[model samples]
Target: MFKRIAATAAATVLAAAGLVACGSESGENAPGEGNDTVTIKIGTTDADQQAWTAFEQKAKDEGIKLNIEKFTEYPPVNPALDEGQIEVSKFQTINYQAQYNASAGKDLRIIGSGEINILGLYWKDHSSLDGIEGEEVAVPNDPSNQGRAINVLVQAGLVTLKDGAPKLTPTPADIDAAASKVSVVAVDASQTPSAYHEGRPAVINNNWLSRAGIDPASSVAADDPNSELAEPYINVFTVRAEDVDNPIYARLVEVWHSPEVTDALNKDSGGTAVQVKRDKEELNAILDKLTEEYK
Candidate 1:
């Protein structure tokens, strides 16, 4: 599933790049120049969501045109933005971006903040974390989501971490199985729903809920978005380092926070998303700290 997502994202980016190349030959001034309407191409994983539909309409009303490219997974969005296939992307948390930046040696910059979707523990047969003792729980194996999933289990009092476990990026190895009530099974993020369907309670990311036919309100337990632990999980709108100060980009960020967009987003996520508002300086400081930690 991950490989397929990567391939599809790559193909979509290549096709978009071709269209951009052909469009460049018209010799028109770039967006945000003089009186030209600012047109920004945004890459996202949830372009089909009603939030984006509302965002597009609001942007149009504000005289800013948007071209949204949808991707199947989070991996390729940043690369698409870095390679100039898209101007900005809205998909990942600060921790995920920090890990990507550290590994890829790229300095993608976050220009705006987005909501944090509380990581949820969903069970098909169980209504609560209780009675799941000695059972196995599935979690996303990716560094960012896996760590958050482990934290969710910890918050639910079903798992205990060993001494000296990394606070931000804990793995199953960090879990003291002898002391914990449940054992964790890590699978690709895309397969978490499958794990849940197979009778194991799964720590599923919010983005997969719609695809897996899981109701967000049905989650047995979830991590608190307002806690200090969740600060790093706040989703963000990111762009190339050079575009960090672009006025049009700043305006676009404001548009994302508008009532229409937020209302639609809340509806789309089934109210699991907690809207976050943070300035760029604070966001950048958090990203810098996380990047250094990942390095």
Candidate 2:
């Protein structure tokens, strides 16, 4: 197991954006007893809370106590999981998890995959290209997702990356032309949607919108997570590598795939997040490919 500091504000924001509640102790609360129950800090924001609210009720029937914790960003969950601040985290994509496992040396494993939504570029002002000719676009720094974002813009005829962008992430040096030329800016995922308010369009994940309850199809450009091109980076549940065989982890995965969870996710997300039940080999192959491709 890895040892990490209690989440710094910035780290907390990046890893599990908007997850922490005031006075909430990291991993201090238990599931059922809130005292002795193993608190699973299921990291998430708006829609996660809403859907998991129902899942938690189902878990109770099985005698498992779950504490649905909220986070705002993507960088904090692993450290929280490692420090015993949380038993598990239910956020992030396979690519993100693979990067963390490789770089942070956290030894986390994919216990299950969450039906996640796709990321789409959005600007609060126009919500379409015709409305704005020259605008600033913000993209993430991660390799695959960042590339995905840039590719989306390029596909939309927005602009192109510097041409040497690695499969994972590309730095400003990788950007050949200034963003001002294409009217786009590269920003953190957490800041993108809000940036839309200031004419800064960003590629945001579906969970972010669900948490905020923003409809992408209504006023934004969206791709499905289940699309042929997107499954490589879909969200997943992660556990300490040692816990890979834990029965509780298996139970949680089972619960997540239940019809109940499916109904809750589909209804709340407006069908953005879709449940794709895969056998272990299929998921393991996906992970292996991710390790090979993203690394």
Candidate 3:
């Protein structure tokens, strides 16, 4: 499913450049080339509220017009970015961005990282992992997120994966259910919260759970992002390879991580996301590694 979506995004990236660019015939919001003031179009999933408004105002004060293009999903953001409809986007983690680039053959690079969302096993009726026995639990079905969901279960002593199962992209088939306490039912990543509300214990993705209004502290178990296995999940600001060092873009990243927008980021993410200041070179190295591993 993810592969198909990625391919579609790639195809859009290939076909959307002239068609979607701002000055072209049919493009809606693409920036005008040679305009006196530069408008940097940014694709984002965050609600247009406190944090973003602060950043936009700061950018405006600095003489950069910030035009935000909102998206509800991740797949289309990259395509729009590749097509020049947006200059950069803040919607994906390092692994997801790497996977999209590898699958799409586009060199989208992470310019700065903002927050880390810890993925966890959340239950509606239950409060702890021990009581989860005999209850069928829901998990993400996508390769990367599924493996992450399963790993949390393993760490919580609920289930175990078979020997040699790829840790980075495991499926339910990799689970040794005979030795496990709970059975895992794989569903689309977006459906985990619904599955949980329907009386099933679910391993929900971080950002989605927060967006669904589920409190982060409600989770029974979660993976430690500080762990080496989970580092790839840190959410980042990404741009095309050509714009990695554009002074204006770099300034935006700088202002984003400063003390000015800290409260807004926390408030907007429901106080569940962690702010991390990672060097550009280090971020690129991790992306390169994940790209090679997942390719």
Backbone clashes for every candidate come to 0, 31, 1
Model 2 C-alpha lDDT per residue in residues 1-295, reported as the tens digit of each score: 0113421332344234323221136544333223423334455544354568667776655545676667777678778877766667777777777777667755677776777665677776564667544666777754656766765565566665565565334444555455424555667666666775565667775556655555766545655455545666666777776766554555666667667777887777776667765554466567666666544
Instruction: Please name the candidate that would achieve the greatest TM-score relative to the true structure.
Output: 1
Cα-based RMSD of candidate 1? 9.2
lDDT of 3 by residue, 21-65 (tens): 222223333323333334677889774657888777766665456
- Candidate that beats the other on TM-score, 2 or 3, i.e. the better one: 3
Model 1 lDDT per residue over 1-295, tens place: 1245643563455345432211133434343234444467888998888999999999878766787888998888888999988888998899989999999999999988988988899999777777899988999998888888999999889999999998777999999999999999999999999988998899998879999999999999999987767878999999999888655566677788889999999998899988898999889998998999899
Each model's lDDT comes to 0.84, 0.61, 0.76
- Superposed Cα deviation of residue 189, candidate 1 (Å): 3.0
The all-Cα superposition gives candidate 3 an RMSD in Å to the true structure of 9.3
User: Which prediction has more favorable lDDT, 2 or 3?
Assistant: 3
TM-score of each: 0.83, 0.64, 0.77
lDDT for model 1 comes to 0.84
Off by over 4 Å in 3: 1-39, 47-49, 61-63, 206-213
